[model samples]
Target: MESEALGHTVMDQRQGHGSLVAVAEKLTLEEINSTGAISNFGKPNAPSPAAIVACVPKNVHVDEVGETEFRISPSEITAAIKAGLDFGGAYRC
Candidate 1:
Protein backbone atom coordinates (compact mmCIF):
# COMPACT_ATOMS: atom_id res chain seq x y z
CA MET A 1 0.00 0.00 0.00
CA GLU A 2 2.90 2.36 0.64
CA SER A 3 4.40 1.62 -2.70
CA GLU A 4 1.04 2.17 -4.28
CA ALA A 5 0.86 5.54 -2.63
CA LEU A 6 4.36 6.42 -3.78
CA GLY A 7 3.47 5.33 -7.27
CA HIS A 8 0.48 7.57 -7.15
CA THR A 9 2.61 10.45 -5.93
CA VAL A 10 5.10 9.90 -8.69
CA MET A 11 2.34 9.84 -11.22
CA ASP A 12 0.92 12.99 -9.80
CA GLN A 13 4.28 14.68 -9.94
CA ARG A 14 4.64 13.72 -13.56
CA GLN A 15 1.22 15.04 -14.41
CA GLY A 16 1.53 18.24 -12.42
CA HIS A 17 4.88 19.39 -11.19
CA GLY A 18 3.18 21.97 -9.04
CA SER A 19 1.26 19.41 -7.06
CA LEU A 20 4.28 18.13 -5.09
CA VAL A 21 6.62 21.06 -5.12
CA ALA A 22 7.39 20.45 -1.48
CA VAL A 23 7.45 16.69 -1.32
CA ALA A 24 8.38 16.61 2.36
CA GLU A 25 5.21 18.41 3.23
CA LYS A 26 3.25 15.69 1.51
CA LEU A 27 4.77 12.83 3.46
CA THR A 28 3.36 11.69 6.79
CA LEU A 29 4.29 9.16 9.45
CA GLU A 30 1.06 7.33 8.68
CA GLU A 31 2.44 6.48 5.27
CA ILE A 32 5.65 5.08 6.72
CA ASN A 33 4.47 2.54 9.26
CA SER A 34 6.57 -0.57 9.76
CA THR A 35 4.36 -2.18 7.12
CA GLY A 36 5.11 0.73 4.82
CA ALA A 37 7.68 0.66 2.07
CA ILE A 38 9.88 3.08 4.01
CA SER A 39 10.40 0.30 6.53
CA ASN A 40 11.34 -2.05 3.72
CA PHE A 41 7.95 -3.69 4.03
CA GLY A 42 8.47 -4.79 7.59
CA LYS A 43 5.44 -5.24 9.82
CA PRO A 44 4.89 -2.99 12.82
CA ASN A 45 6.78 -3.87 16.02
CA ALA A 46 9.89 -4.96 14.12
CA PRO A 47 13.36 -4.08 15.38
CA SER A 48 16.04 -1.93 13.80
CA PRO A 49 18.55 -4.75 14.05
CA ALA A 50 16.32 -7.10 12.12
CA ALA A 51 15.72 -4.46 9.54
CA ILE A 52 19.42 -3.77 9.27
CA VAL A 53 20.14 -7.46 8.98
CA ALA A 54 17.60 -7.81 6.22
CA CYS A 55 19.67 -5.33 4.24
CA VAL A 56 22.74 -7.50 4.67
CA PRO A 57 24.23 -9.49 1.82
CA LYS A 58 23.15 -13.04 1.15
CA ASN A 59 26.59 -14.35 2.17
CA VAL A 60 26.73 -12.47 5.41
CA HIS A 61 29.34 -13.10 8.07
CA VAL A 62 28.12 -13.05 11.62
CA ASP A 63 31.08 -12.82 13.92
CA GLU A 64 28.87 -12.21 16.91
CA VAL A 65 25.26 -11.41 17.70
CA GLY A 66 24.74 -9.42 20.84
CA GLU A 67 22.07 -7.10 22.15
CA THR A 68 24.06 -3.94 21.40
CA GLU A 69 26.61 -5.00 18.83
CA PHE A 70 26.58 -6.71 15.46
CA ARG A 71 29.60 -7.76 13.46
CA ILE A 72 28.32 -8.03 9.93
CA SER A 73 30.52 -8.93 6.99
CA PRO A 74 31.85 -6.24 4.69
CA SER A 75 29.32 -7.30 2.09
CA GLU A 76 26.57 -6.23 4.45
CA ILE A 77 27.55 -2.60 4.01
CA THR A 78 27.49 -2.97 0.26
CA ALA A 79 24.06 -4.53 0.35
CA ALA A 80 22.75 -1.82 2.63
CA ILE A 81 24.00 0.89 0.28
CA LYS A 82 22.48 -0.89 -2.69
CA ALA A 83 19.17 -1.14 -0.92
CA GLY A 84 19.23 2.56 -0.18
CA LEU A 85 20.01 3.46 -3.77
CA ASP A 86 17.32 1.16 -5.07
CA PHE A 87 14.69 2.76 -2.86
CA GLY A 88 15.85 6.35 -2.44
CA GLY A 89 13.41 9.02 -3.44
CA ALA A 90 14.17 12.39 -5.00
CA TYR A 91 12.54 14.06 -2.09
CA ARG A 92 14.62 14.52 1.03
CA CYS A 93 13.06 14.19 4.45
Candidate 2:
Protein backbone atom coordinates (compact mmCIF):
# COMPACT_ATOMS: atom_id res chain seq x y z
CA MET A 1 0.00 0.00 0.00
CA GLU A 2 1.12 3.49 -0.76
CA SER A 3 1.22 6.24 1.83
CA GLU A 4 -0.11 8.40 -1.01
CA ALA A 5 -3.35 6.51 -0.41
CA LEU A 6 -3.69 9.03 2.44
CA GLY A 7 -3.51 11.80 -0.18
CA HIS A 8 -1.60 15.11 0.21
CA THR A 9 -1.06 14.76 3.94
CA VAL A 10 2.54 14.65 5.14
CA MET A 11 3.53 11.01 5.43
CA ASP A 12 5.81 9.21 7.81
CA GLN A 13 8.99 7.84 6.21
CA ARG A 14 8.47 4.54 8.03
CA GLN A 15 4.98 4.05 6.61
CA GLY A 16 6.26 1.44 4.18
CA HIS A 17 8.40 -0.38 6.75
CA GLY A 18 5.83 -3.16 7.11
CA SER A 19 6.07 -3.21 10.86
CA LEU A 20 3.66 -4.99 13.22
CA VAL A 21 3.84 -4.80 16.98
CA ALA A 22 1.97 -6.86 19.55
CA VAL A 23 -0.75 -5.31 21.68
CA ALA A 24 0.30 -6.06 25.23
CA GLU A 25 -3.04 -5.31 26.83
CA LYS A 26 -6.73 -5.24 26.10
CA LEU A 27 -8.94 -2.30 26.86
CA THR A 28 -11.37 -2.49 29.74
CA LEU A 29 -15.09 -2.11 29.08
CA GLU A 30 -14.94 1.27 30.79
CA GLU A 31 -12.23 2.33 28.40
CA ILE A 32 -14.18 1.02 25.44
CA ASN A 33 -17.37 2.70 26.69
CA SER A 34 -15.53 6.02 26.67
CA THR A 35 -16.29 6.17 22.93
CA GLY A 36 -19.29 5.01 20.92
CA ALA A 37 -17.03 3.87 18.11
CA ILE A 38 -15.27 1.32 20.32
CA SER A 39 -18.38 0.21 22.21
CA ASN A 40 -20.41 -0.25 18.99
CA PHE A 41 -17.96 -2.88 17.91
CA GLY A 42 -18.64 -6.56 18.73
CA LYS A 43 -22.40 -5.89 19.05
CA PRO A 44 -24.89 -7.73 16.84
CA ASN A 45 -27.02 -4.59 16.36
CA ALA A 46 -24.13 -2.19 16.12
CA PRO A 47 -24.29 0.85 13.81
CA SER A 48 -22.53 1.32 10.50
CA PRO A 49 -18.89 0.21 10.35
CA ALA A 50 -19.53 -1.70 13.57
CA ALA A 51 -22.31 -4.20 12.79
CA ILE A 52 -19.75 -6.59 11.38
CA VAL A 53 -16.74 -6.71 13.61
CA ALA A 54 -13.60 -7.15 11.52
CA CYS A 55 -10.98 -7.27 14.26
CA VAL A 56 -12.03 -9.05 17.43
CA PRO A 57 -9.95 -8.83 20.58
CA LYS A 58 -8.96 -12.08 22.23
CA ASN A 59 -9.90 -10.60 25.59
CA VAL A 60 -11.92 -7.76 27.05
CA HIS A 61 -12.46 -6.69 30.64
CA VAL A 62 -16.16 -6.30 31.36
CA ASP A 63 -15.57 -4.82 34.79
CA GLU A 64 -14.55 -1.27 35.66
CA VAL A 65 -10.80 -0.47 35.52
CA GLY A 66 -8.47 2.47 35.34
CA GLU A 67 -8.43 4.45 32.12
CA THR A 68 -5.40 3.74 29.96
CA GLU A 69 -3.16 6.07 28.02
CA PHE A 70 0.10 5.61 26.13
CA ARG A 71 2.70 7.51 28.02
CA ILE A 72 6.46 7.28 27.43
CA SER A 73 7.69 6.43 30.88
CA PRO A 74 11.29 6.98 31.97
CA SER A 75 11.88 3.24 32.25
CA GLU A 76 10.49 2.72 28.78
CA ILE A 77 12.81 5.38 27.46
CA THR A 78 15.78 3.70 29.12
CA ALA A 79 14.70 0.35 27.71
CA ALA A 80 14.44 1.83 24.25
CA ILE A 81 17.91 3.27 24.61
CA LYS A 82 19.26 -0.11 25.71
CA ALA A 83 17.53 -1.65 22.69
CA GLY A 84 19.22 0.90 20.43
CA LEU A 85 15.93 2.43 19.40
CA ASP A 86 15.86 6.10 18.47
CA PHE A 87 12.95 8.49 18.67
CA GLY A 88 12.32 10.06 15.27
CA GLY A 89 10.72 13.13 16.80
CA ALA A 90 7.52 14.24 18.44
CA TYR A 91 4.55 12.42 16.90
CA ARG A 92 2.52 14.35 14.34
CA CYS A 93 -1.14 14.06 13.45
Candidate 3:
Protein backbone atom coordinates (compact mmCIF):
# COMPACT_ATOMS: atom_id res chain seq x y z
CA MET A 1 0.00 0.00 0.00
CA GLU A 2 2.88 2.35 0.73
CA SER A 3 4.24 1.62 -2.71
CA GLU A 4 0.79 2.28 -4.06
CA ALA A 5 0.78 5.60 -2.31
CA LEU A 6 4.09 6.54 -3.86
CA GLY A 7 2.65 5.61 -7.22
CA HIS A 8 -0.33 7.82 -6.50
CA THR A 9 1.94 10.77 -5.91
CA VAL A 10 3.73 10.09 -9.15
CA MET A 11 0.44 9.82 -10.93
CA ASP A 12 -0.84 13.05 -9.47
CA GLN A 13 2.28 14.90 -10.52
CA ARG A 14 1.93 13.48 -13.98
CA GLN A 15 -1.66 14.56 -14.06
CA GLY A 16 -0.63 18.09 -13.16
CA HIS A 17 1.91 18.22 -15.96
CA GLY A 18 0.59 18.91 -19.43
CA SER A 19 0.61 16.01 -21.88
CA LEU A 20 1.50 13.59 -19.04
CA VAL A 21 -0.50 10.78 -17.52
CA ALA A 22 -0.18 8.18 -14.77
CA VAL A 23 -2.44 5.45 -13.48
CA ALA A 24 -2.82 5.81 -9.75
CA GLU A 25 -3.43 2.79 -7.55
CA LYS A 26 -5.45 2.62 -4.41
CA LEU A 27 -4.27 1.74 -0.91
CA THR A 28 -5.88 -0.84 1.32
CA LEU A 29 -5.35 -1.95 4.90
CA GLU A 30 -6.55 -5.49 4.50
CA GLU A 31 -5.04 -8.29 6.58
CA ILE A 32 -3.01 -5.78 8.55
CA ASN A 33 -3.89 -6.98 12.00
CA SER A 34 -0.40 -7.97 13.08
CA THR A 35 2.34 -5.96 11.48
CA GLY A 36 2.13 -2.27 12.28
CA ALA A 37 0.95 -0.33 9.29
CA ILE A 38 2.41 3.07 8.53
CA SER A 39 0.32 3.45 5.44
CA ASN A 40 0.31 7.07 4.28
CA PHE A 41 0.00 6.72 0.53
CA GLY A 42 -1.10 10.31 0.16
CA LYS A 43 1.93 11.46 2.07
CA PRO A 44 5.07 10.16 0.47
CA ASN A 45 7.28 11.66 3.17
CA ALA A 46 5.62 9.37 5.64
CA PRO A 47 7.49 6.29 6.89
CA SER A 48 6.42 3.75 4.32
CA PRO A 49 8.25 0.47 4.76
CA ALA A 50 7.16 -0.59 1.31
CA ALA A 51 8.53 2.58 -0.23
CA ILE A 52 11.80 2.23 1.63
CA VAL A 53 12.11 -1.34 0.49
CA ALA A 54 11.32 -0.35 -3.05
CA CYS A 55 13.99 2.38 -3.12
CA VAL A 56 16.75 0.37 -1.49
CA PRO A 57 18.84 -2.45 -2.84
CA LYS A 58 17.21 -5.87 -2.62
CA ASN A 59 20.29 -7.92 -1.72
CA VAL A 60 19.14 -8.31 1.87
CA HIS A 61 18.75 -11.82 3.27
CA VAL A 62 17.24 -12.93 6.57
CA ASP A 63 16.79 -16.27 8.30
CA GLU A 64 14.44 -18.47 6.32
CA VAL A 65 11.00 -18.58 7.86
CA GLY A 66 8.76 -19.73 5.10
CA GLU A 67 5.07 -18.87 5.11
CA THR A 68 5.12 -17.39 8.59
CA GLU A 69 3.52 -14.33 10.06
CA PHE A 70 5.36 -12.04 12.47
CA ARG A 71 4.67 -9.29 14.98
CA ILE A 72 5.90 -5.72 14.68
CA SER A 73 6.95 -3.57 17.60
CA PRO A 74 5.72 -0.04 18.06
CA SER A 75 9.19 1.01 19.11
CA GLU A 76 10.54 -0.20 15.79
CA ILE A 77 7.98 1.83 13.93
CA THR A 78 8.77 4.88 16.01
CA ALA A 79 12.46 4.41 15.32
CA ALA A 80 11.92 4.18 11.60
CA ILE A 81 9.75 7.30 11.63
CA LYS A 82 12.39 9.15 13.58
CA ALA A 83 15.11 8.05 11.22
CA GLY A 84 13.09 9.26 8.29
CA LEU A 85 12.48 12.58 9.99
CA ASP A 86 16.15 12.88 10.80
CA PHE A 87 17.15 12.14 7.22
CA GLY A 88 14.69 14.69 5.94
CA GLY A 89 15.83 17.24 8.47
CA ALA A 90 19.44 16.74 7.50
CA TYR A 91 18.84 16.69 3.74
CA ARG A 92 15.99 19.20 3.61
CA CYS A 93 14.00 17.09 1.21
Q: Write the per-residue lDDT of candidate 3 for residues 1-93, one digit (tens) a residue.
A: 876876754445545754332322232334342233345433568564553331333354447844444455667766776687566542211
| Candidate achieving the largest TM-score | 3
Model 2 per-residue lDDT tens digits across residues 1-93: 354685655535565332312321455555544553443332467454523223434455544754444355567654664354234321222
- Least accurate 10 contiguous residues by lDDT in model 3: 19-28
For residues 1-93, write the lDDT of model 1, one tens digit per residue. 876875744455465666656574767766534324443323346355443434433454445842443456668775765576567632243
| Candidate maximizing lDDT | 1
Between which residue pairs do clashes occur in model 2? none
- For model 3, the superposed segments whose C-alpha errors exceed 4 Å read 1-63, 90-93
lDDT value, residue 16 of candidate 1: 69
Residue 44's lDDT in candidate 1: 49
- Deviation (Å) of 32 in candidate 3: 30
**Between prediction 1 and prediction 2, which has the larger TM-score?**
1
Better of 2 and 3 by TM-score: 3
